[model samples]
Target: MTRPQLTYRSWATALAALVTAAATALIGPAAPAQAAAVTFTNPLAEQRADPHVYRHTDGYYYLTATVPEYDRIVLRRATTLQGLATATERVIWRRHGSGEMGAHIWAPEIHFIDGRWYVYFAAGRTEDIWAIRPYVLESSAANPLDGPWVERGQLQPARSSFSLDATTFVHNGVRYLAWAEYAGSNSNIYLARAVNPWTYTGTPALIATPTYAWETRGYRVNEGPAVLIRNGRVFMTYSASATDASYAVGLLTAAAGSDLLNPASWSKRATPVLASDGRTGQWGPGHNSFTVAEDGSDVIVYHSRNYERYLGNGYDPLSDPNRRTRIQRVYWNADGTPNFGVPVPDGLTPVRLRSHDLPDRYLRHWEFRARLEPNVTNLADSQFRIVAGLSNASAISLESTNYPGYYLRHRNHQVWVERSDGSALFRQDATFTRRAGLADATKVSLESVNFPGQYVRHRDGLLYLEAVPDAAGRASATFALD
Candidate 1:
């Protein structure tokens, strides 16, 4: 309800034009034009990881994502539902001591109960970063900006040794928590009634398991569970297989009156609900959380390894930060089930991509607060279009802007804190930097020539293209820009 206020600016002008063209297209990503997007607020950015957006009573939207470092929980609040995607963030909880939470704290969610705020997340024991489980912390303050978060302890279900990805939902007046855990033989998804919000009731129930050939990718995994109730039906969606590879998502359903504990009452859908678009080369596209669009549309936010398999095998860059986050809309199939098909075709927008009904923030950038000083021109004062080049910058140089002092900037992808003289190594806290290859200058254009049907804005910015699919590195858009 308390969404941020944003006014239209010049940066988003061209995007306003594209939306008109996008409206008249006869395709899935393309759609009939409705109303022009009026910029509101958006919070998710290039660095926020493992994002989970939650809607609360005050009408304000709250979001928390796993920082790439896996050490702290980053929280952002915005007035409008979509604004949370672009708002400034604050680190709410941090690791203390050495074991469990001291390292690898991930997937934190901020929830409001009775007047107080609480956040639930999973972290590994200090000694071993892999011995991870869910833990809760509470805040007494009205806003999460500043709070004394008291540790509420862990919610480990009985019998199951390994577990994580916990979330709570209130259905028909009863509140229950659902999560994914492995019980020795198989890594599957499960559900349980929360005695309260932080603990489970009785025994846990199995909602889904990895029985299919496709569900098992990196490891026998079925995790990241989010429960949804629509038109009197109970549904649970869980991420499947390894944290890497073509990460997939699956769904399970239970009738209104059926016992949630009865696996018989719940039936797993035969096919995967979400997966990677091989053509886009963005693999392992699972681990998702749902949020409502400004106009009540469903938005799916998940992370993916932008480039090919870069990590998990010693010194691979893929494991470090290349595993960026991405998002797309989820539509309903004729049967009424949420149809989260594969992602958009990399560069070009999805054929029928539902604009989050967000303000004009999409297809635009306006964060540049520093005034552009008029530079000495090489071409006698000609005005140039500030276009997105081989990466993600919205830069304007007088053609002479190519030089160090008159450099182009993509704020999101800019490597913060680089060496003063533009060396490879620099401090970590720096805010902006000149994009790579800006000096080398590769042509930035529509990627239609590279992949045909799909068109990409090969802008000049920090897009860590993939190496696995071999050709995936060229002419595509990834979350590094998201």
Candidate 2:
């Protein structure tokens, strides 16, 4: 007999009912079911730049980006984040043949506001392709993809000159619009209070500009503003420099309840929060937006090219078609600031293993040697893919992110990441059974499959497979996966 495949909605409903029934029988009231974890490979979509992902309250995720053609606005939707990889894209609107909205359509961002859908984008005229300005479209349809969109004309935030990349956010019952426009020769980020989705009421304030050396490389630019509010603070991230390998993300912050229109309320970080990393092979990671995962963890969505050099005929950045959309988890620091780690290499999403006993230390490989270290400079070296074991499907193996074919294995009671030799002994030596932490039941411990009494533990800042029969040994073996 064959069984029907279960959809995510049906499976989640069944799981919630089972948890509720069990809780009511044992305790007084039913408890809420926990959400399943989400993971996806790098380069979520190809030939997509300035990516924006918005999670709606109707149980779906909507995505839009700057397509290489720069002639139409497209949108896609999926129930799961990874499902957006192969989701069918629909073009909602196209550029005009001539006149105002006739050429160079770019950086379209979709937003749901006040029970309606709005799309803000930039375009140039037919006669002059470089005379770019921001524009808007409105739709009352419940689904944005199936829209009879009405053009609202150009958005004049101020005396606009070479303006683009418009993004909007609401705070304290008032909406605000932010975008990048030229003040003389320097492109700077500006903000203003919005009277409606497409119009602003007050003079735009200059929030950020290209001043530092990193922001002024190639060309002085500060564009693509995205906002995230959390922990009594508002974080505004914008891209800087030219749209090449020098492009990076800088941050501006202010108190959640403070006056957002005042330029003095915002503080700029001296260095970039996210940029190119040679170790991960991701170049020019910028123009980022934020969304929440299935498990309620914060996720950052951005675009980056795998290679540093332009693969097109000329040096024009617009000619490159490899700026693919990518997503990664956003980690928070102890002081409540966000830590956007380096762009992870292509593969299954990696996780960081934090030592339970020493909270600051994490499992990492240095020069192919396994050790527990703090403040690791190369974040890719500390990331690993916990996959099914090579020997047994029931066990697990830790695969290095940077070194694709390498895994953590124990030889003569010492743990090191080595290339698999594909032998039965090597498989068993690499595989481990995950068990409840012996020191803290809430955490996890890795027990050696071949050596029943031994576990992967840290001693003298190095990793080793040893017997964990004592309390100190158990503490050293426990870890918290992030």
- Number of the predicted model whose TM-score against the real structure is largest: 2
User: Residues 252-339, candidate 2, lDDT per residue (tens digit)?
Assistant: 9999988998989999999999998776788899998899987688899999998886324568787776798899887676567787
Lowest-lDDT window of 10 residues in candidate 2? 27-36
Misplaced by over 4 Å in model 2 are: 1-37, 157-159, 310-313, 355-361, 364-381, 387-395, 401-407, 411-444, 449-452, 459-462, 470-476
Candidate 1 lDDT over 1-482, as tens digits, reads 12331233222333433543332231113112332121211113444556677777767778787776777887888876434544677878788677657867877877787678878888887788777778888888878877878888788443236667778777777777777666776777777787766778776888788887777755677788877677568877777766655467788888888888788998888777766555445666666777775556677777766545522656433245545445555555445667665553332223121112111111221132211111212111111112222222322111111111222222333311111334322111121212221111222212221222222222233221112232333323211111
Instruction: Estimate the TM-score for candidate 1.
Output: 0.63
Per-model clash counts, in order, read 48, 0
Which candidate has the top score in lDDT? Answer: 2
Please give the lDDT score for candidate 2: 0.83
TM-score of each: 0.63, 0.84
Q: Rate the local accuracy (lDDT) of all candidates.
A: 0.53, 0.83
User: Alpha-carbon error at 203 in model 2, in Å?
Assistant: 1.2
